[model samples]
Structure formats: C-alpha cells, structure tokens
Target: MNKRFALLLLVLLPLMACNKQETPAPAATPAAAENAAPAANEPVPADEPAASGETPAPAASAQTPAPEAAPADADAAAAAPPAASGALTPGTDYVEIPNGQPYLPLNGKVEVVEVFGYVCPACAQFQPLVNSWEKKLPANVRFTYVPAAFGGPWITYAKAYYASETLGLVERTHNDLFKAIHIDQTLKGERGQDSVADVAAFYGKYGVDPKQFASTMESFAVNAKLSKAKQWAIRSGLEGTPTIIVNGKYRVLGKTFPDMLRIADALIAQESARPAP
Candidate 1:
C-alpha cells in the first residue's frame, strides 16, 4: 500500500512540470505575433501631408519672342546662295552688273546712301523697311538720302523730305505717308502748286506748322540738298527713283524695300571690312 501511494505522487509531479512549460510557450507565441503585425501595417505619420506641401512648384521659363528675332531672321535669309560664275548669262534678267562689285560695302566704315523721291511709289515702299535697318546700324557707318530733283514735281518731294528732317518727323511720317499714298490711296494731286500744297497739308495733319513747312521747302538750305541729289542721280546710274547706293560705290535698286535692305546688308557687310576712311 505504501509503494502504491509513493508511485502515484511521483507521476503527478512530472505531469505538472510538463503542463507549466507548455503554457509559457503558448503565451510567448501571441506576443511575437502582435510585434510582427505592426511592421507590415505601419501607421501613416500625421506630418506626411505637410511634408508633401513643402515641395516646390514646377517652373516656367520663357514667355515672349526676343526683340532681335526679326532682324536675325533677315540675317539668316541674307545668307544668299553663292551666285554662279557669270558674264551675261542667258534667261537671267540680272540687275547686278557683270563687271560691278556687290553694292554693299562689307568693310570698315561702311556708308549707305538713299536715292529716292517722295512721290515715287518704290521709294515710299523702302522708307519704313530701310528705317528699321537703320536702327540696328553701326555708328561708324553713315546713311544719307539723295532726294533727287530730277523733275519739277520731284523737287517738291525732295523739299518735303527736307522739311520732315527739320521737323524731326522722318520716322513717324516717313512710312505713314508712303502707306497713305500707295497702300491706302490717299494722296491725289496734279504735278504743280496743288500737289505741293496737298503734301504740306499732310505734314500739317501730323502737327507740323504749315507755314513753317512751306517756308522751309523754299529755303536755300533745302535747295542745296535738292541740287546735290540731282548731281548724284546723274552720276549714280540711277534711271529712276529708289536707288540705294552703298559706300558711294555699289548701287541697289529698291523695287521691294525689304529685299533692297537684304541686298544692302550684304553690301554693307562687305564694306565694313575695307580699310578705314
């Protein structure tokens, strides 16, 4: 009976120890699972939205076209294809001469001269376009116009140009008058006193004193310019109006003023490189 009681007590003690060990393992398993779950499902921080707000805005660089683009476009176009070796080629109605050098002086101290008449349609076309080129022109270069008095009617136009010069309205009314007559078809008069009066009225409309304008047109100072222009016209091979002489040498016809400028530009570049005066 004593042996039986002792055997039962030993068995119970061993079983109790095993049960205690098993209970600790089950408790440890639930704690480990809780720690692992947080890593995969991490909480979004409260400052995430604020941090995104701190990022910079996308940039905008250019807005409008550069002011130099128009002239630059002209420069690119002025890169004219080289002319074929020539001496009176057939099928080519050539304005440039066989023996003559390119009109624009592409050397140092280039000079530009305008041979024009106010009533001339072609000269009127060239005034504004040439004026633009004048703005970008170098200081070393000089520009002059031969307001040729080839005829009685042409004398009035030359005098008008001289009047505008004295009044400082060349830029404002130079192109405007051209368009007024040619494009808009405004100026109308016979080649006489009526025509002179009409043109003076046009100047007056732009705020020039009509009396002063008329007075200057008849002045000795204006007459001198008209006389010199007539002399240049005889010497410059100018058949008609709107001939632009570059550097006192090459002459370009101003049929289309912009095209005239292009030819003039080419000649001017060449003139700019010559020995200084």
Candidate 2:
C-alpha cells in the first residue's frame, strides 16, 4: 500500500477497535447513510446557559393535580393524520435543544449547521450527499459547516479549517481536503506530519503562505471561532461528527442518508413557519 493509505488505516483502525457497538440506527430507513453514533458519555463540554440556544430548563417548584381525560371520538381519530407516515417524530427522529440556541441566518433565512470532522469516515461519506442536498435547499435555508474540535488530531483539522477560511482558501480546499484525506489518502495523520505545521504546508500549495497560515492558526481570532464552535457542538447536544443541528433547535438523527435529509427538510419547514425573530 502507498504510504498515505497505510497511514490512514493506522489512524482509523484504532478508532474502530475502541468502538464496541455501532451507532444505533434510528428507526430503519435506508442502509446507505447509516453511521455509528459516537459512543454515549463521550466527554462533552459543560453546558453554558449563557450561550445562545442553551437556556437551561427551570426547576419545577410544584406538582399540579392530574386533569380529567377527554372522551375519545372515533371521528376525531379517523380525521387525524397517522403519525407513522409523517416525516418526523419529536424525541425519536430529532431532539429539541433546551431554550434553543440563537442562529445567525443571512437575509432572514433559517440556519442549518452540519457539525462534522474531516478525519471522520462517516462525514466524508456523507459529504457528497449533503453537498447535493444543500444545493436543492430553499433560498430561505442558510447552511454552514462547523468542524468538530473535540481535541487531539481533530483539533488540528479544525484549526486548519478556520485558518483556511482566514486565508480565503476554504471554498477551494474544503472538499479537496476531504478528498485528499479519504479518497486519495494523501493527507495521513502521522504524528510529526499531521500537526498544524503540517497542515500549513499542505495548504501552502494553494497559495497560502506557510508563515501566515501558521500564525493565523494560532491567532486569537481563530481561537475565538474555535471556542464558539466547541460551545456550539456541546450545546447542540452533538454526540458525534456528522450530526445536523437545525436553527439551533433540533439535532437530527436518521437511519439513512435520505432519512437525515428528510428530517432536516421537515425541521426547515417547521422553522420557516415560525413568526419572525
């Protein structure tokens, strides 16, 4: 095997070994888009109530008496649409984040953020599908990508992403970087060569100055973005890479790629129906 492909296997094999159970698929939908969920109890940053969309639930002070049950009418039951055929199920398909985080949408659009990582195989696999789905989204749906910054080598990738944005290279390099790492297997995570310095060198070919790239990677501005990203991932109730947060309110979980997009479509419709601001 080529050196790059070999290195990738080395990085991925260990992660596979540590994972004992695959991510539990939500209700069955499609097989193509299935990805293992990040192990439960993975270290999530403590929730900061002050963060947008992260309002903590208020403590209940009292319990009220139970209400009387209303009479069930066969007519009403027949008139109601079946829940099984619906596009989404609250709590099952997606979750409502407490106090919903604030979203920054352009031109009064609803926001959709894909919380993903470059090193993740699932994210890479999901990219083309998401890219196509994104293009077909309504003009009112605003989309952005937030690289996972949970630390270790992934932190380096996140820094690289932000740095590329700083240098105006993201649009050109984002997909290419994924291609390099996953398909081409050229961007291996070998220790000495996978650091920020290494990422700078790789992007250098795209006209980024290595010195400037390294500096930008560590700059306070980039760090601030990273901090916000970390908080968003934490508050979005993100259990793993490839999770989708819609309007800072819902974290979509799907059994298939189409299922995920279907959930997102429904959430977007719901968000679009909300009264302004």
- Candidate closest to the true structure, highest TM-score: 2
lDDT for model 2 = 0.65
- lDDT per prediction? 0.51, 0.65
The 10-residue segment with the lowest total lDDT in model 1? 44-53
Evaluated at residue 276, the lDDT of candidate 2 is 84
Error of 1 at 139 (Å): 4.0
RMSD of 1: 41.5
Question: Model 1 misses residue 6 by how many Å?
Answer: 99
RMSD of each: 41.5, 12.0
Assess candidate 2 and give its TM-score to the true structure: 0.71
TM-score of each: 0.56, 0.71
Task: TM-score for candidate 1, please give it.
Answer: 0.56
Error of 1 at 202 (Å): 1.2
Query: How many clashing pairs in candidate 1?
Result: 17
